[model samples]
Target: MTVISIPGSKSVTARALFLAAAANGSSTLLRPLSSDDSEGFAAGLTGLGYEVVREPDRWYLTGRPCGPAAGEADIYCRDGATTARFLPALAAAGHGSYRFDASAQMRRRPLAPLTEALRTLGVDLRHEDAEGHHPLRIEAAGIKGGELTLDAGESSQYLTALLMLGPLTREGLRITVTDLVSAPYIEITLAMMRSFGVEVTRGGPGNTVFTVPPGGYRATTYAIEPDASTASYFFAAAALTGSEVTVPGLGQGALQGDLRFVDVLRRMGAEVHTTADATTVRSTGGLTGITVNMRDISDTMPTLAGIAPFASGPVRIEDVGNTRVKECDRLEACARNLRRMGITVATGPDWIEITPGTPRPTEVETHGDHRIVMSFAVTALRTPGITYDDPGCVRKTFPGFHEAFAGFAEILDRRGPATRP
Candidate 1:
């Protein structure tokens, strides 16, 4: 078995940063993910008057717990969806005249819903040239925090952001979310919030109502879990190469919903086992294709998509309509890239069906989305001759992706594309 050290969870790191900034005192985040996305979150927090000290194993912070400076707060998310969605709610809970922007790609994503929700709570939000995207400004007056209802159809981060803001509001908040997708991610948000000594109540008539009282987060030390979504790519490597791979520090007790991706692998004829400290995926035989709804674990849909051509039948990915608004149009990107590999692909408003065939040697266009880049990299294990025009796009989350993946491939490729047709 090859051993791999996965990075800390991106979801946990972002939530930790937010909670730490919202806490009344100082806090330490142990083993937070160090990536462009995470760094973007850190920068956004710093712009809001929080002081963040980055170290190798952990990050230290001095919480403002209130708001940014009075005049202007300019924060750039640099294309991280979590940062773009979560931070606005954070600012609204505090005090400021804040301006938020992102990379051109992120500007194309949906921020209107979150902005509109914030406005419902009395944020003076203004669109800067564009109607519903970034480069938007908000005069943050600290949320009045009343009962409200909104659509969570575009992204669950909207709900997660609002839920994070629940405790900070003056009157707390009662939010009813309709058309919710990726509900498990909200669980991650709630779990990390609890680690920060705050609680969000979720038992109501429709189960759609979440209540968070006026008490904000407490300053505390929190440990981050390994990135299960990132680990999924490695697990996909095992399934593709008929090798066994183990990702330590990620197991049954993990806070990430994407850890259930192993079950998806197990359903596809891979042998998966979990322990207190790690999750292991051992290749049983050939990869089998099946119909899967990736809404709950949408982050790994691209990983599964990359391996679909190696399976014997068609693989259908459903309920991932939200992915259209991610770092890129993931559905369309996958469809285009799979076609470039000489495979068959079908797409709908919320699904993709991939047919197995031998792939052609072609340079993949990453669209600068880290998931798109990393997922397609896995195909090189079975298909070989696969290359990317810009492999460094994985730096968005996994900065050392190329070197790490090369090492794993070296170990697995000692046998070279096992059981390939």
Candidate 2:
């Protein structure tokens, strides 16, 4: 049995950094994620003239809630979607000029909906390179939040960005979402906001109307919880290899909606136990596949698909049509990767079905997506041998993913300069 204590959640870290930068005092973030994606967001803050101090494991960010210090800078978000989406709105509300751009992969990701909504709020934003895409320049202007409609069918991140910034807008914002997906992630945003002394009102099932008070963000200390999405890899490893693994910092009371994955694990014959602060999962017997509707929790689809071939029956994942717009088309990637392993996998626009097949070694390409890398790493534990290209992609979320998986599998480094012979 191996116990892995993963780092803080990337989702939480990005959101906290934004909130801390928007607050009016010095905020210290403990156990912050130090990776390319996270560092890119922190760098964006620094570019906007905010003081961001990095320690060994914690980050100290001095907030200038009024606006950025210099009031104008060029911000490059790299490949981080959280930074790309959230920073634009934060910069718009400030009294400065800013320009944002990202890598090729990020360029492919859409930002039109958020931009259009920001434009509706009177932000002076212009597309430098591609219209409805990244490489945007924004002049510091105040926002008047009123009735705004956004198309969230493509990515829930667009909606979350509006939701997070709604509280900071002048009149507070009334957001009307059309075809919103990833509802659980929105719930996470609301919960985190409330924890930091912000109130959000959900009008009804699909309609959310938020009212941000006239005052600014309330400064306070916040500790981010462990990432359930990152924990999925360890749980998958245990299920595939019949190993007992305990993941600390995740329990029955976790605010993260992805924690529901434990229910799926229990159904698949893994012994699941939860305490006040930790969740332990052990595979007691062979895995029995089950069907799951993953609309609210699409992030776990890759992890679940990676181990589906080891189950006794077919594992069906449904209602994940919006996953097409993630860092990559996850459905196609999962199917393609599983086929490489000799698994009988079928995929549709909104569903994927996987049946157990003969185990074989295969090479999986991560496509620079962190989930893809972590999910296939779980498969490496049970298969004869599996190699990954661009294993460094795990830095997007869990920078120490390879080290954590090392407790249960043999990790061979084959990358440049870091190759182990």
Candidate 3:
């Protein structure tokens, strides 16, 4: 079995950056992700006048609990929603005037819900470009938190942004979410908050009330775990090509909710073994397809779709319409990219069904989404000469994805200058 270790969780990295930026003292984070998304987040913190140091796999952030530096500045979030969403709220909490903008894809993603909620909290923010899109001009003169209703049906990152910054408000914050999706991400938020000594009370399912104490975040050293979403690609690779793959640093009891992907692998007829710190997966028999609802774990949709073509029956993925607002329209990208490989796939607004067919080798376009890049790379194990446009996009989440793939698979022409899709 080929063993591989993925980087720390992007979810964890973004949250830890926010915690460190807002903490009372300097905080050092180990094994943080160094992808484009994370880089943009770190840049945003630095642009706001916080001192940040980046190493090979660690980050040192000196907190500015009082707020970012004086003066209005433009903080470009690129296409990083975690940076775009969380940084604005953090800046607003500390009373600063800043303008936030992103790439075209991020501009299309909605930010109104979070902005409106912040407005309800007495922070002044005006949309510079589109009514509900990016290029947001935030005039932060401090905020008084109150109860607010948020429509999180489009993206859970909106609610998570609010939840993360809610404690910094004067009154604390109570969020009543309507049609909240990607619920597992919320669990990650709560868990990370508790790690930093912040407490939040869960009213019930889909209802949460947050109470940020008078004192702000306390500085603490945190070790980030391996990303389960990134691990899914290798597990899918093993299942698709009859190879034995062991992903170290990920246990069955992993904190990431996406760790349930191993169960999905088993459901597709793969043998999975779990240890205290790793999960090994291998194809047991001929793979049989099954239908699955991936609401809580939508991040795995692309990997599941990429592996579906190797199954004996049709693989159906359901309850992931919210993926449309992610870095890319994941459902549509999965279906379109699989079709590029001459696979028979069907897609709806919220579901996808793929039937195995004569797989043909073709270059896949990632739409600059890391999951799309990794998902299609798994298909290369079974196909011949499959190249990915902008393969470097995987650095957005997994900086070592190409090197990791080269360990077990034959990677052709990866050293040349990266090609944009």
lDDT of 1 by residue, 262-286 (tens): 8888988899989999999998448
lDDT of 3 by residue, 53-97 (tens): 999878998887667875677999988889989999889977667
Q: In candidate 2, which residue ranges exceed 4 Å CA deviation?
A: 204-207, 410-421
Clashes of each: 0, 2, 0
| Clash total of candidate 2 | 2
Give the poorly placed runs of model 1, Cα more than 4 Å off. Answer: 69-71
lDDT of 2: 0.81
For residue 402, give model 2's deviation from the true position in Å. 1.5
Model 2 over residues 7-79: C-alpha lDDT tens digits? 7887888888888887778888888777787889999999988899998778888887677787678888888
Clash list (residue pairs), candidate 1:
none
**Model 2, position 270: C-alpha lDDT score:** 85
* TM-score of each prediction: 0.97, 0.94, 0.93
